[model samples]
Target: MKKIIYLLILTLFYSCTVKYYGYVYDIDKKTPICNVRIKTIDSLNITYSNENGCFEIKLKEKVKELVFEKENYQAHNLRTLSIQSGEFMKELPFGDTIYLISKNSKYSRPKTTLPNNVYKK
Candidate 1:
């Protein structure tokens, strides 16, 4: 009985997660950007990049934006994010894939050209 309880506890702890992954880039270098700060628009949750320019955060519902910032790189705001996975919402998944690019102190990123219903005024 003790062994079984121990196994159950281990499984429960290992099965939990609280973050999603994201990619960052530099437009001029056309390369993966490292050391950038990424956070929820609410300024509550935040994270930074790994060597591969990837990051993760576990956020609950009600998050409105994901902000990115770096020195020598303009700040970028990504809005209208919806993590509508239904049963899969707890899987710690990423939203729309974004490629942030910057040039001459300006920034641009690829987003769904089509209109998004999540847009807010």
Candidate 2:
């Protein structure tokens, strides 16, 4: 009976894993970015940030890298993240935020451009 109980406890302890919550923010504005896309580097798994710029992704086996992107923001490729799985509810440092650069001009001009000579007098 002791041997059976020990085996069950060990199996339960080693079988635990957790999905982490991630957040996306604008690097320059320091604000949350909504509707952002998130994907794994080595797999087809993909997820998106909600209105609050937060997302949760389950690590596929041992994948530790994710790529984030949105329409106007430059894609933020997160590589080589330090992963600590098996914790039921571990608190992550400020490292959960992924910063992204804007693809638009510094002036935040509209992405559209008029055809040549359209602005000609």
Candidate 3:
């Protein structure tokens, strides 16, 4: 009886945690973006993409939101619920591809020429 109860508890604990695997990429370039930060919005769980842009994060089932960030790129927010709503791919083992938009592409300004007199030391 004790062994049965222990097994049940172990199964419940294991089922409470979920692992999400995916790769990050540049939206415009269609190339992998390495070192992107992935974190749970409501928890301390965090991980980073590798040189190949592959990453895996283990989060509690209760965590509904994820935030992805990187330098010079726009931050992306993903809701777990969207996956169930068919907004995101349902595949797990094969993983998903997350695209990030470069900040420069979104907010580029025209260059202005400066006067030569301003170059005086």
TM-score against truth, every candidate: 0.56, 0.59, 0.65
| Model 3 Cα lDDT, one tens digit per residue, 84-105 | 5666545334388988888777
Summarize candidate 2's per-residue lDDT along 1-121 as a digit string, tens digits: 9999999999876666446577888877888988888887754888888888898876535455678879977776765446356544434443478878787637344558779999898
Q: Write the per-residue lDDT of candidate 1 for residues 1-121, one digit (tens) a residue.
A: 9999999999877667445676786766667788888888778888887777777777655455678888867688865345575533323346434556564534553444756765866
lDDT winner, 2 or 3 = 3
Between candidates 1 and 3, the one scoring higher on lDDT is 3
Weakest 10 consecutive residues of candidate 3 by summed lDDT? 85-94
Rank by TM-score (best first) = 3, 2, 1
Model 2 / residue 105 / CA error / Å: 5.8
Where does model 2 exceed 4 Å of error?
Answer: 1-18, 82-95, 105-121
